[model samples]
Target chain A: MIQISVDEQACNGCGLCVKDCPMNVFEMGSGVSIPRRPENCMGCLSCHEICPAQALEHQGVVPSRRMYISSRVCSMLNRVI
Target chain B: MTKSFIEESQQNFQHDLMFRVEDVPLKCNPPAAELEQTLHGLMQMNGYIIRSLEEIAGRGANAVTFRAGKKFGHEVAKYFQKKDNVEEALRELSYILYGQYSFEPWKPADKDHYIVEENGSTFIYLVFHDCIVRQTLRRIGQEQSGPLCQTLCGYVVGAIEEITGRRAKLEIVHTGPNACLKKVILK
Candidate 1:
């Protein structure tokens, strides 16, 4: 239920994703990161954090909670904008 | 006033600690926003305390938090009816331990085969998407997987121990900005 994409142009073929993914979801394919075992991906987005080029993308995954955003920052923004 | 990102993140939390005190005398209880803000602060403070304890005590912090977490875990266990079946209890426990929006269970593609077995140990993988500790660390620009994480591990083991009367452990598989993977080992 998760779809992963790699931006070929954006990808530097660092293989960091392949190395970082606990599920072994990515594999280096001809100097490009490929979702070789996408089904294994648990949508932890560990690849996203490791990829320096920001080439990986995932769809159909639940978004993380952002309600923890600082109240001070929000209160300041409420007054400014 | 325009809605802030805080409100957008949690629609019910429409205001960031804004209070309406234009009432007769004063209210016995605090406003909903105040209660919510207090909870947010409490969670953040938990993180801060862990980090501070770590700085002062190093590995000693883990022991302190672990004991506290286990105690809290037992306290939480009192609320739930103990199930005779281990798997059934775990299924129920997941509802409380892994919240709907925060920590979520990561099931394999094989829906029927939900629980994974490796090296003769049964495991349930949980993917934490919205962890308060993670948020707190990010707020202070501190790295993740510190001693605070051990508290959660202890909590899980403690809860399972109380509920099922079986010793268990929580293993941190991996961590990331968006999500983290934790494995609950059934012993």
Candidate 2:
């Protein structure tokens, strides 16, 4: 199961996550975003990308495959990061 | 024969560049390093080409890619035996579609599909995992559900139509970074 948390202090009342999430996983309450249906989250991370406030945090989601990145770049990135 | 100075220089240059001292070995599957580099370059080039096509030709580019994907879909369906029903047909597809790109039915809460009471319509949802198209778009930071995504839409529609011998359409319900949810409607 995936767990998502919204930082109320960091939330700027932007509803981009609510509007962009394909699964209808988030809803607005008191001008803040709420994870109305966390079970439906498919872990596409669209909400995470669209959020300007970066108030959403999710855990326990499978990371997507990383084969698309070039091997050289990945090797270089691995060294530092 | 005496050692040729030119040949020695060529070998040294090739070694310094980390290239094969001799000509690249010929093989159907060249090498992982070369293949990954080619795929990465191709995806970036395709990203640019697709964006340019859309910018210049608009929907024309989509029609072109959709048709190409449809042809590929038809070709893929030819390899499998036809099934009696849609479920069975899709089950056949799901059976073979795996590896680098995989498809799985979205059965949230164990509900296989959604049924509409008003007209008794049924909609089957499929989540595409490890999609290469998504990977390609993401590599260039392009938006999802764009024209490139249409190729997959056409492919699903084509494959389903051919396998089930019915007219089918695939709709994008949501485009996420990792996976995408699509609705398959057969007529």
Model 1, B1-187: lDDT tens per residue? 8988887778874567645678465574777556766766776787677778999998888888878778878788767877756578776677657653256567656566657777866777888777766766766667777787777777777787778776778888888877889888877
lDDT per model, in order?
0.77, 0.78
Best by DockQ: 2
Q: Once superposed on the true structure, which residue ranges of model 1 sit more than 4 Å away at CA?
A: A71-81, B1-44, B98-104, B107-112, B116-121
Error of 2 at B37 (Å): 0.6
Residue runs of model 2 more than 4 Å from their true location after superposition = A78-81, B1-28, B31-34, B107-122
* lDDT, candidate 2, B1-187, per-residue tens: 8669998888777744456588775775776666887888888998898899889988788888788778878888878777757678787767545554576667465453552222433467787877878888988988887788888887777777778887777888888877788888776
Docking class of 1: medium
Tens digits of per-residue lDDT for model 2 on A5-30? 99988888788898888677889999
What shift in Å separates residue B31 of candidate 1 from its native position after superposition? 5.8
Sort candidate 2 into its docking category: medium
- Superposed by TM-score, candidate 1 places the C-alpha of residue A77 at a distance from the truth, in angstroms, of 7.8
lDDT of 1: 0.77
DockQ of 1: 0.50
Question: What is the lDDT for B143 in model 1?
Answer: 73
